[model samples]
Target: MNRISARRGGASSPIFARSPAGSKRTRARIRGAALIGSLALAGAAHAELLKFETRPDGPNEAVVATVKLDGTSHDIAGTLAKPAKPAKPPSGAKALLIETQSSDDVKPLALERGLAVLTLDVAKLPDKARAPALRDVLGHLRGALKMKRVLGRAQGSDADAMTDAASAFDGLLLHDANREPAAPTRFIETWGADAYWREKPRVEFANGAPPNGRRFYLAGIAASTTATNCAAPVNARPSAPALRALFAALDEWTAKGVAPPAARAPLDADLAPAQDLKWPKIPGLPAPPEGARRVPKIDADGNEIAGLRLPDVALPVATFTGFNAQKNKKGPPCAAAAAIPFAATKLDREKNLDPRPALVERYGSRAYFVATVRVIADKLVKERLLLQQDADAYVAAARSAPF
Candidate 1:
């Protein structure tokens, strides 16, 4: 028999001294590693929960809640993920708070994918206290606007109050103390619009701006199907130009100094220039709004549905384009198309992404989350609710069906 030397914990020490029978050191090393790992795990704990300073006279001011990692809840704040990077809002850009009536968990699915998210839980507000609180904030913003006009300057406290209130409501509180306002303070209150009577409001009120504020409300209740309805004349879809028009209108409103009661417009120079993002040029294509555009899905049928467009199209098309499963005599690509482009190592002779896990680990959890969610969604589509051809169309409908 050949003579053998032994080591312990990768060291030359006799810590791995042969058992009376001269057994290998592997077992001892494995046990030692396990013990070290167990001790390390026992020392760690989850971060403490941060409390929102609820104002007695504010929305959810009296709301008190707690969130645990494993226990699920309907609360959005409860699902807060630690920020993956040191990302801040665009300069002069404030938080993009969503105030929707839908379940908080529902909208964050969209927000967590990318759009700036802050869901205001309207139901948490006690009925007896809702009206007065709304009135108070509105009055305060209105007063600040007036003071700025009379004194040729607003008191620091007044501006702070407006910023604070807007911040509280989860609106982008662009600080303009010195910078000129870039857009008019035109109000886009969700409640006053006549659109609500036409269809079930798909726009989650809780996932958008305060109804009482002077910001563009993507009236979740009224236009949940904006992407699909864009091409439909009867539905008044928000076309690409229509979105740009909203921005242009705001630019004009700011230039004219036409400030709404809940909005304060100081100067245009203060606001940052709006970058021209390459919005999808395809007509009837459903593209997500800023911060929520990571993955956009379109309704293959002419109906509205919550969808994720097939990912990584090698050849880009502006509209809904698909191969006929019957005529093409091919199986459906929908099953895995969204993730196909990202998976290919080379496309059209171009060297593409190396299909590797190293890149994902370096990018933080977002990539992992997207991939995992996509896989889960794929499984859901294949074995569960997503495959029904009419699923998208039915979900596009605004009203909730009672069981």
Candidate 2:
């Protein structure tokens, strides 16, 4: 057997000893070391080491920590954000919000809800090694925080690794990149095209067997694109509403120790007609290559498919596209989508190609537009698609808009 070394708080010690067969002293030493390690972990759990640092881009302080993986001796960068006063987490269930990527858009909301948000970046590890590395990281966290429940968010190809590592957690939220959910893992595609979409699956087993003692895969939703796409820019962050709903569901499960009801049937938000519509050829611009997918499809009502419909889309202030053309051919397949301002005045509305007359014409007045927003907000809240707090904020913003 190979020797193992354990390090914590700038102290290092050999945790394993090789011994001659059937040696009583060596067996006792091994048992003693295991006990010591467990005690150390319990002690560390009581020490809350989270500290705040000013983020460069914003004035808000970010909770940051350095976490060393349990076995690999690899130090992983971590960030945490706590609520103003931590809510009493579910009894005997310490919940951790984990993100495999460095940046998290939902960190603020998570913190506001009194959940500690932990962000981890395992990009430095090789692809094949990331799954095991993630498992180790989760083990260290579970031991050091005394956590019994974990909620994770991962994107792209990393979703597969996260799923593999889900055995270490009570629940996981994966956003796969156009890949079908592997079986024994119950999955549902919520929205978007078949080629590029998001899937939310509850993974309770690995290769047809449960890997741990934990049961109950909580409710989760994952998009097919980059996980960041859920909350990057303010206007386009459709995933925010969905995430809030998921968290609420998770809270219930953690507190009550009951799994949510079966996953809801997926809604097909595809804009079938838009797929057949072709853009008029521009004289100077080159034509799109053959076999390229047509992005930016919109329904007759002008909403894009496969996204959480925020007030921005439901109420209609501007047309937001989630995909744009790359400036150069060598650039990414599609540029980030942007929200184009709708015409606020009648003259601009008449001149604009995609005139949004509804803002001024349909609602009839600014006050009416704000009222319309409130109505939509209430409907979304009832559907559980938008949180009440966020719905109020959205309505308030609409009231102040230059409609």
Candidate 3:
């Protein structure tokens, strides 16, 4: 949130000023003060709150608190959103504390399930201090905030600290490589096959998942990005369908003692070298990247046959791939994934000599395509992988999608 401050002095740049005297006094300037604004306004009638207190952060809510660590006070900040409740407050007090950079999409998922969503700012601490700081913040959540159980999600980079502090949380989701969790601490690790990197993973997937330690390989999915540097259409499949259901399963496993869905990433065969892959000749498509960097064996479709199939993958529209062609002669490919739409009709497919089936041959019509998406979305929701609202949204977006 921008904390505005009054200024009377002149500066090189244009200064923002606030008018006073019933819209009659535009002053010299107004500026934002880092700690100064917050501290300066301390004790004001509407000063920011403390101890589960909150302030409006634009359209969202920001939970603000000050907690002590090693005799120093640190601002513990995060967006806090509570799920809708009836006349009487919900009997349970639970929350999910996620690192700021962790996916924001999952916040609503936790809220929908009655788990209050909080931010985990302790990851900003130094490596040596993050564990203790996380523990301290979590203690504050459970003790001072009166939350009975506090869950957490963080990126893989924070694994060391989160693992050390795992016992402080009831459940933890880390989007990183596999790691052994401290005993009795529920944990899940996820890697979406591609991170916005141009190069594919240099290593092959292996088995031996830890007890209660689940993993997901978002195969055939491109890393999420807004950049258009690729030679083809960017593939950004809606992760909501996958994540909605995944979060639900995670909640059931952590709160109700149910089992998480079996991990979907199993690369039984070693990755084959780029030169060895028997890629089909698709006219007009860029050549595959040449490197020893291997990939899991793929089916007729570019994606691996196993693992979770998002609606886009389950029902084909175009070849949705996380990998996009690098326009440069020699360097990393575009950071975004690509979605190459199939020909609209069999005649068009033959005209282009495209090996992939035409959209008409595959889906018949746009109406049928949308109906199929609804069916997939509904099934995922039933499996606890997709939320109903999100399912509806998917169907809605499908209606307007270019078939």
Better of 2 and 3 by lDDT: 3
Cα lDDT tens digits, model 3, 273-315, are 5566665556645566555565655566565555567676778
Candidates sorted on TM-score, descending: 3, 2, 1
Query: Which residue ranges in model 2 land beyond 4 Å of their true spot?
Result: 1-75, 80-87, 90-92, 102-104, 112-114, 176-238, 257-297, 305-307, 327-334, 353-358
**Which lDDT value does model 1 have at 177?**
22
Off by over 4 Å in 1: 1-89, 92-98, 101-116, 131-186, 190-403
lDDT per model vs. reference: 0.25, 0.48, 0.60
Name the candidate that leads on TM-score.
Answer: 3
Q: List the residue pairs that clash in candidate 3.
A: 222-322, 235-337, 235-338, 245-385, 245-386
The 10-residue segment of model 1 with minimum total lDDT is: 333-342
Compare the candidates by lDDT and give the number of the best one. 3
- The estimated TM-scores of all candidates read 0.23, 0.63, 0.73
lDDT (Cα, tens digit) per residue for candidate 1, span 27-139: 54443222221001111221111112122322222322222122222222211111122264221222122322323322333233223333334244333222222222223
C-alpha displacement of 80 in model 2, angstroms? 4.4
